[model samples]
Target chain A: MKKILKFIKYMMTYSLLILLAVFFTFPFLWILSTSFKGPENLFTWPPQFIPEHPTLENYVNVFKRIPMARYFLNTVIITSLGVVFQVFFASLAAYPLARLRWKGRDLVFKLILLPLLIPMQGALIVNFITIVRFGLYNTYIAVVLPSAVSVFGIFLMRQHYLSVPPEIEDAARIDGCNEFQVFWKITFPLVRPAAMALAIFAFTAHWNSFLWPLIVLRDETRYPLQVGLAQLNSVFEANFRSVAAALVLTMVPILIFFYFTQRYFIEGYKGAVIK
Target chain B: MLSRKAQVYLIAFSFLIAPLTLLAIFTYYPIIRGVVLSFTDYNMMLGKAKWVGFRNYIELFKDEEFYVALKNILRYLIVVPFIQFFSILLAVLVNKRLPGIRFFRTLFYVPVITGAVVVSITWRWIFHIDGILNGLLLHMGLIKEPIAWLSDPRYALCAAMFVTFWRGLGYYMVIYLAGLQNIPSELYEAARIDGASSRQIFIRITLPLLKPTILFCFLISTLAALKIFEEVFLLTQGGAETTTMMYLIYDYAFNRYEFGTSAALSVVFSGILLMFTVINFKFFRAGSEGR
Candidate 1:
């Protein structure tokens, strides 16, 4: 009797879980179906849950109609550069804060992070004026420079750095490795997990960055993926498939990047929850 | 001796020199300039500013749109925290060592990484007149006519609210699950041995210990909500008085091309957010430490 009752409970839970999964999964699935359907397929009554016929023409139109490649290229450059610098600079910044027994380091670390709480919107007017003053407004440098240093990345490296045993560095120093050399050879390798974690975080943040890029990059040629997609959505009248196709194009790379780095996904969450 | 030692210490700081230079030039410098610009009429095109003192803040209080935005945002600040509190509660319910639970978690988390664009797009379909929501309502006999989910100013804010609630619940739940798991099982075992019911155990033990995680989630989510930019921008365009302060800043800085007023607005907005966060932190600390 108890076994049957237990089985019933398990069945109920699994059924509910499956239902919820379908609810969550439907949006992405619907997008794929929409992108694959014909132009007439979009406004069909009772909206087709499944595509009767699928086509790649929408994807083609998206590229041909607008400079989709430019957007993708721009996003790739910004995201890649942002991630590299964040990890590199974060490592450089976190090392002294964590390992090197330096004076007033704690005070300096806290002070540097003070700006994190202030919203980017708060700095918009000043940043815009300053960027224009420096003649960098609408330039790619404007898109990348303000976002290069991440406080969260610094904290992630610092937290992981705390658990690293000091003797590894001491051994390196015994071999006549100076502070920079020790950091490059010994400390860097030890923090691979945290670096991977930071890479994923920085990558996603830069990939989906919208508002700042939307404001700064006035030239369509210089626009990132999100801004460019917004432009496509606005101009492409009654063309849902092309919009859907463009959306799919934008999202797929991040998902692929995510799929290959799924292990780091969980590891990143673990690393973040350390505090 | 101290001066020599200080000089050497400063000289060894190569990383600091460059980064601090960048920070000073880009981050800190702009902030100071913004504050100063708020005091003056620093028009970008005019290439000059007239100092007007506290007139900006004074007029801001009298502006009706400012008041409406403030009220809506305050309502958001009050209500959204409790909504997420309920979400954390939901997460706790299903965080048990039950079958196929991890799948549910991933399902919940799927909407989070979809980016704001996709979320806004999908939700538009969901809330359209002939869309799934109205279809479901009609099928269930809830209403005779289709409701304008984002059209009417009345339902517009509510529409934004729903998207935020749906998208944010998953991320907060994940954080709470982590917190719940970190708890030692022996405490629960000990409580059970002492004849404590589940509800009592939760009140006395679970909620108290989960303070830090709750604090972290609450702070981050509130900050994210305070920004409240992308979804509204995508959905409403802040027409029909749906503008939040962040949108207001965007409008001033970009649309109207008023740098001085925008700088003033940004200062006020940051002040409000900073004050809100500091107060929250204080309350959180007091509540957690008092018991």
Candidate 2:
């Protein structure tokens, strides 16, 4: 009787979990279905669960109606450039703070924390002023430079680096490997997981970046995907199918990128946001 | 070779201290600029900002939209936590470590990362007169008429809050999971050994231990809710005059070309966020030290 009760409870628990998972996963499945459904089939009375007729027409219309190509290119350029520069600067800066014995090191790390308190929006207020003052407004460099040294990246890398054994650095020094060589040859490889974490961090941030581009980029041609999509949203009226298509296009890269690097992204999310 | 002490000093100067001069110029400068700009009659677009001494803030004091947005925000700040706490309770049920629980976890997290725009769009469709929600409700004989969720001022804010809750719960659940993992099972085992009831163990062990994570979730949620932009913009467009401060500020800065006022509102906005940041730091610091 006890064994039977245990089995019943086990079955009940699994059944509830499966139901909960399906509930959470519903929105994504709906969006995917909506994106693929025929124009007429999309707004049906019952809302077609499966596409009665799936067509690529909405996607084709997305390209033709809007500069989807330009938006895609802009997204590629800014995210690619921003991620590369952000990681390089963050790690380069993190190297000394993590491993080196520096004066006022604790104070400096605390100061970096202050910037983390200052959200990207706060920085945007100043960054906009700086960009215009330097005549770099709407320039690609303008978009990338201000955000290059992410404090979170610096902090996370510093955490991982401080855990390295002291003996490795001492051995490198005995082999005539100077600090730069020690960092490049010995330390960098040791902190690969953290670096991977930072790369994914920078990529997602730059990809979803909307408010910054909205403020700085003026030319319609120059707008990144989020900003471009927002503009597309403003200019159109009843192209719901195409609007849905554009959204699907915008989300595809993120979904694909997340799928490929999800484990790391998950790891980074766990590390960065401690509830 | 120089002694380790000397090397440490050199590294500190080069790596940590040197980079800060740039940060001082960039991060600190803008904050000061914002404070100064808030008091001035600054315009948005032209960039020829001149100080007018408290006029912009004074004008802000009189703005009707500002009050509405503030009231809307405060309502969320006060009420959303209870809503979220309940949702999290629901999530914990789903998060039970039973068979197929991992599948449930994935389900909860899927909406968390999906863009805000898509979620808002989905919800907007559902709340339409002929949409699934109304259809389901009517089929269940819950409502006499299809409610005008988005169009009615009475329901618009409530409708937006529903979307916010739906979009946000999954993200917090994951955070809760992280906090949950930190708890050692031995505590529960000990409680069980002592013949402590399930509710007694939960109240004593889980709630107290989860306080820090709960605080963290609260802080982020409060701040994010204050700056809830994408959903409001997509769904309501600040409809029925239910504009958020961020949306209003975005309008002033980008649309109306009131950079000075925009900067002022931003200064005010960050001041609010900074207050919460201080609270979070205190909570986390105390919690960490307690351990």
Candidate 3:
């Protein structure tokens, strides 16, 4: 009887989890279905989970209506630049603070934390002024510049660096490695996992970044996927199918990226946020 | 061997140069500029800015939309605790080594990895006047009318909150899952041997130990709630009801070109954020110390 009761409880738990999973996964499935349906089959009396007549006309329309390819390329450029610079600078700055003994090290660490206290959205007005003053407005550099060095990245990398054994650095020094060589050859590679995690985080962040890019970039040709998609949504407000298609286009690349790198993303998040 | 202290300093400085320069130019300068600009009458279109003293702040105090947005954010923050609770519940459930659990975890995290625009677009469709939600409800005989979930002011903010909760649930769950892993299984075993009920163990051992992670998630979620702009912009375009502080700031800076007003609002907005952060820090610090 006890064994039967245990089996029943197990079944109940699995059923609940499955029910919740279906609830959460429904939207993605719905969007995929909607993206394939034409306007005629879009809003039936009962909305279909699976399209009656699936078509790719919406995908074709999305490209023809707007510069979908251009926006995708622009998003790629901005996200790549932002991620590369962000991770590079973060790791570079993190080395001295993490492994090396230096004066004012603690002070600099605290100084980096100052930016964390200021809500990033609240600083936009002045950041806009700074970007214009540098004559970078409407340029990709303007969108990427403000976010090039993340405090969170620096902090995360610093934490990862601290866990490395000092004996490795001492051995490198004995082997005639200079300080720069020690970092480039020995310490930096050790934190590649953390860096990979940071890269994924930064990649998705910049890819999805809307407000800053929306404010800085004036030309429609220079707009990233998010801003361009927002404009497309407004411009084609009545066309649900094409909008769905555009969303799928914008999301699919990152979704694929996330699927492969999710484990690193989780590890990196644990390093950065958990402790 | 080059043992010179100056060379050691130079290498360190070179490593620091790029990030520090960028931080100085972009972050620190803009922060000071944000404060300075707040005091002056800076208009982007006018091509000149002059000191207007407290006029911007004075005017801001009377702006009805600012109040509404502020109130709306306060209301939106209600999602923080709700998300935290559900996320913790999810973390505990998924912490088990069950079959196909990885798929369930991935499914939960899908919306989080999905960007704000995509999430908003998906939810907007789901909450459309004749959307699937209404279809499901009508099919189940849950409601008679196809409610205008996004269009109706009464439901607009609620709809946005629902989307925020849905998107954030998995993100926080992952954090809590990490926290749960850090916890030793020995504690659960000990409690089980003591004949403690599941509810008793959760309340006494799990909840108390998870305080730090809970506080961390609260801080993140609260700040996120305060900075909410994309959802309002994408879902409702700040129409009927869904205006937030960030949305209003965007309006003043981008649409109206009132740089001074935007800066002033930003200063005030950041002040409120700082207050909350400090409070949470104190609470977390105290909680950890108590334990």
Candidate 4:
């Protein structure tokens, strides 16, 4: 009797879970279906959950209509540079604050965390002025530089570093390894998981960063994937199929990256939030 | 080689220099400049900054749009708890040790990484008068005529809020899942030994243990809601009743070229955000302690 009851409960839970999953995933599936559907297949009275006649013409039009390749390259450059520099600098900054015992370290860490309260969005006006004043207007660096040093990255690394045992560092130091050697050879390697997590976070963030890029870049040639796709809405005002195709095109790389790194992503997300 | 103490400081400062310098130039300096710019009539095109003593503030106080934007943000607080409930529910449902759960997790998380632009565009299509939402509703006999989800003033803000809720639900689910995992299994076993029902255990153990995570979710979600701009820009274009504080600031600075007014508006906006942060911290802390 108890086994039957347990089985019933399990079935009920699984059904609910499956229902919610479908609801959550239906939009992406819709885009996928819409992107492949022929022009006639769209705008039916009741939308087809699956495309009756699939074609690649929408995707072909997407590449032909917009500078898809350049936008991809631009996004790659910004996301790669953004991830590398953000992780490198954040790890470096987290070291002293996390591992070493220094005077005013706590105060300095507190100062760095002060930006958490002030929304960076609110400071857009000043940042816009600052960027223009520096003569970096309409450049990729203008979009990438402000975000290259993330307080969240620093905070994440520091938390990871705090979990490292200190005796290992002491052992490295006693073996005549200098502080840099200890960090480079021992401490840094131990925190690779945290760094990997931070890298994923930084990569997806920079890849999808739109608002700052939207404001900072005026030159159409320099726009990243999101901004370029946003501009396509105006250029392809009535062509929802092609716009859907372009959306899928821009989304594929990030989704692929997420698929491969989702383990680290979830673990990293858990670490950051739970801590 | 330098003395050990000197070497320590050097290594520390070297690591700290690049990020600190960048933060100072981009973050701290801009913050100070934002405050200073709020006090002056600084036009970006005119390149002239004149001291205007609280004139911007006086005008802002009398501005109807500012009040409306503030109220919109206050009302948008509905998303915070709405997301929290859904996130926790999803997290609990998926927290089980079951087969094929990873696929579900990944599926749920897809919307989060879809980026704001994609989310806005996808939802814009869905909410169109002839879009899937209306088409589905009409088929279900919920309404006779197609509804303008994005254009109608009554539904515009609600539509934008729904988009936010949809995009954020998955992201916050991951957060709560982490919190759920941290609750040791021994508690559940002990409760079961005491002949506790599942509902009783959930209320007596899960909710109490999940307080901190709930607080964190509330903080981040509230902050995100308060700074909502991308959705407004993409979906409604800040039309009708959808203007938010962030959108208003963007309009004042970029559209009108009123940098001083934008700066002043930002300062006021930042003040409200700061107050909320403090209040949230206090209330959550008090709630936790009382528990």
- Best candidate, DockQ: 4
Tens digits of lDDT, candidate 4, B144-227: 999999999999999999989998999999889889988899999999999999999999999999889899889989988998
Per-prediction backbone clash count: 0, 8, 0, 0
Summing lDDT over every window of 10 consecutive residues in candidate 2 chain A, give the lowest-scoring window: A39-48
**Candidate 4: residue B131 lDDT (0-100):** 90
Descending-DockQ candidate ranking:
4, 3, 1, 2
* Candidate 3: Cα lDDT at A148: 94
- Worst lDDT run of 10 residues, candidate 4 chain A, spans A116-125
Q: Say which prediction, candidate 1 or candidate 3, comes out ahead on TM-score.
A: 3
Look at candidate 2 and give me any clashing residue pairs. Answer: A101-B8, A102-B12, A275-B213, B39-B54, B42-B260, B43-B259, B44-B258, B44-B259
lDDT of 3 by residue, B1-291 (tens): 656666667777889988999999888887778888889998675557999999989888899899989999999999999999999999999888888887788888988887888899888888888788888888889999899998898999999999999999999999898888777899999999999999999999999888888999999999999889999999999997789999999998888888898989998998888888999889988988989
Worst 10 residues of 2 chain B by lDDT: B13-22
**What's the best-to-worst order under TM-score?**
4, 3, 1, 2
Q: What residue pairs are clashing in model 3? A: none
State candidate 2's TM-score. 0.89
DockQ of each: 0.46, 0.44, 0.65, 0.67
Q: Write the per-residue lDDT of candidate 1 for residues A10-95, one digit (tens) a residue.
A: 88777876776786677677777888887554544566877777789988889889998899899999888888888887887788
* lDDT string, candidate 1, B1-291, tens digits: 557456536534865665666677778887788888877867677568899997776666677777777767775666467657866775786687876676577667777666787677767766766666777787678999888887778887878877888777776776777678777899999999999999999889988887777777778778777778777787778865678888887887788776667778888888888887887789778877866
lDDT of 2 by residue, A54-152 (tens): 888888888887898898899899999988877776777788877876567777688787877775344556667778888988977778777777777
CAPRI-style grade of the A/B interface in model 2? acceptable
- Predicted model with the maximum lDDT: 4
